[model samples]
Target: MLKIAMFTLAAAVTASVLAPTAHAAHSRIQFLAPSGNIGCQLGATPDGSGFAWCKADEHGWVTPQSDACPRANVPGAIGEPGGENLQLAEGQAPCFGFVMSQLFFDGQYAPPTLGYGEKRSVGSITCSVERAGVTCSDSKSGKYFQVSREAYKLG
Candidate 1:
């Protein structure tokens, strides 16, 4: 009985020591440009594609409560729906709107470009860029949305 109690205590101590480390690893945040208003947490999709989700804060500070993109019905390897794609020029910033935003490159001196269908996870919901526009669909949900760069101005 004494041996069993000591083993149980040791196991509990081991778990307590490792619990915070595991949680911290999972909550690691990928920092984007500190000067930019948008911050993204990046990872891989189930199909081995890059994935990321971003939030925008006007003050260039990112927090958990910042506005993020709509959650995808299907998630990537890291369990997110979006990826990074919009490249911005130097001195440029993100332009966010209802459930969408424009992305910029880290350094350059050109106009920012819209990241339409640039980042996506492969699953029930799939997205692609075509001549007509950026198209996405969730087969399970039977939902679809599109964006046209020609119809909108970049930030």
Candidate 2:
């Protein structure tokens, strides 16, 4: 009985000590910019007319959301959807009733590298179907940098 109790106590202590460290290690790579006010709508006319509502937030969303284009690849930086035949295209700038604002990643993103207070401008938005289902195109929402998650591959 004494040996069993000792083993149990040891195991519990070991687990408690290592649990937080393990979680922190896996918690690298954070989204850091355009961290708020994200929405999605179809290409419609002016005056917010004929606008359709899609999913608002995509953070931690496991389901895939398709983009204007069909498919894309990640970690490659710039991704062009469709085949070599059709060139990837970007819609017009966000207007009163044109491109609809879609998914958002609003939060203080700080990977282990840059730490915090680092800002990356999401230049162009690309619509790609990733393993996580359909991912939003790299729009102003995706402008980010490789601060820390570079070390780990989330795939």
Candidate 3:
């Protein structure tokens, strides 16, 4: 009786741990290519927030990993092609804990643009857009990136 009870308990615990991973593995990757001069292929979540990679354009790719709006938000709608930047705003407050990344012409890591008082985190790197363009710092690794643009340059 004891062996049976222990076996049943262990099986239940294992099932609980593996259920979420199984469900996540089943997530589908959908592609979206809108009509017009967008010149990009977007991969979005079922709730409508993901990434876009453009081909043969000065700007490379942009990703907005947010959990707010769920109705087909595009990179052009924010500010792309012209500014070559993208933002990821999360949570109910909308723009809080946002992470933005800019696509550089030289295929380098461009610091993301932030709002007047917005702060963002990408892994161990924390960044923000100030009057001097976008500045990112990784305290753990003692690394940083700062790019300067005109005031109010971020769109």
Candidate 4:
């Protein structure tokens, strides 16, 4: 559970102006890419706030491990860490870091597929699915991220 919470916090932000009712529990909305090579999820975090993230079958290239994170596998790293997650929050920029959990993949979910030109939204985050990959972003702050087998970008 700790790891999963970390996954939700991976894109955590310090502030938000969205209404409280906007993030009510069980409001999660998620979908799988047409090819199932990618999955995306947007929902309220454990803290009662909300976030969005996605995962790839085996991401091709990701941002190098963040400097702010406690090192993992390093001789003197402070915490169990590695850049293995992609995260996005409502008011902050996305991040790549150590949050060892699968936020999107779910065998029992039967999540619908976002076709090449479709879109999905939950709260303030909206995602667009394209033939090449998926891009999810905050509608309020205009922050967002992208994920694909070939590459990723967080803006």
Candidate 5:
């Protein structure tokens, strides 16, 4: 009887632990993008923010990773046609965690105007673990760049 009771208790405990594993948690964060172009690579480093733009007209060639540009490996490189996750560094832009993908972009706007500075909305892509809360950063559209919030949601 004693052995049977112990086995039953162990089985119940194991079931409780495994039950929670069946249900997975998810998190979603949204940020606003500028009214301008899309496909620009935007990322944040622990120190500051960084963006990669392609100057096809000026450089006579497309290259964001070249020595001339400040943000290399940000969005994409020549022949790559950059995407949201342009292999940006998360540690550098502590403000935002990492590059996820571009959620919004105005199709009407032409590639960023020269010297005018094409602004874009940038944010990170992240999720939670073990049903815990996750922190994510998003950017707001404006002249000044600021972290919108630390989105807390289920994993």
Candidate 6:
């Protein structure tokens, strides 16, 4: 009975020490720019690689029509749906994406604002919400994507 009690205590202590660290490392990453124009998400892939993504509420720019986008007659698609969202994957060039849908939730369902000048990092990728726009990049690849109402850039 004494040996069992000591083992149980040891297990409990070990779990307490490691629980917080595990949650911190794998917490979900999702937020929006304070401008209310951009939403971003940083997360891990099935292979454990990280990627960053952001989308604009409105933009002056247009993406080249791809068959995948099809100038859809759908909501949240606006004009050219394919290019409204930008993505930067680990060690890969930034690219435009077709959001496919634009359904949005109201009130508490909406993600919290990242606020201008705020930055978040997940592994090697870092993203910043700025007055100019939202920018996300990969340190190892030196690749980034920035987007706003007026323009966007990939490098």
Which candidate's lDDT is highest? 6
Task: Please list the C-alpha lDDT of all candidates, in the order they appear.
Answer: 0.38, 0.28, 0.35, 0.67, 0.30, 0.73
lDDT of 2 by residue, 1-155 (tens): 99999999999999999999996543222221232222222222222221111232323323222243333222111343321111111333211112222234333532112212332212243222222222233243332111111110111
> In candidate 6, what are the lDDT values of residues 9-68, reduced to their tens digit?
999999999999997656447788877888877766656677777888777888544444
| Candidate 3 runs further than 4 Å off | 1-113, 150-155
lDDT of 5 by residue, 28-127 (tens): 2222223222223334433444432211111222222323212343433333323212232332332212233444444653333212222333343321
Candidate 1 CA-lDDT value? 0.38
RMSD for all candidates, in order, please. 13.8, 16.9, 16.1, 13.6, 14.8, 6.3
- In model 3, which residue pairs have backbone atoms overlapping below 3 Å? none
Best by TM-score: 6
Query: Model 6, 26: alpha-carbon shift in Å?
Result: 4.2
Model 1 collision count: 8
Model 4 lDDT per residue over 1-155, tens place: 99988876764532243445565534777678988888766766445445666778776684576654334311122344446556676666676555444535557756778789998776677888998889988888888888898998878
Error of 5 at 130 (Å): 33
- lDDT score of residue 141 within candidate 6: 89
- TM-score of model 4 relative to the true fold? 0.64
Q: In model 5, which regions exceed 4 Å deviation?
A: 25-155
Q: Which parts of model 4 are misplaced by more than 4 Å?
A: 1-26, 46-49, 68-82, 98-108
- Once model 5 is optimally superposed onto the true structure by TM-score, how far is the C-alpha of residue 42 displaced, in angstroms? 23
- lDDT score at residue 25, model 2, on the 0-100 scale: 47
- What C-alpha root-mean-square deviation, in Å, does candidate 3 show against the real structure? 16.1
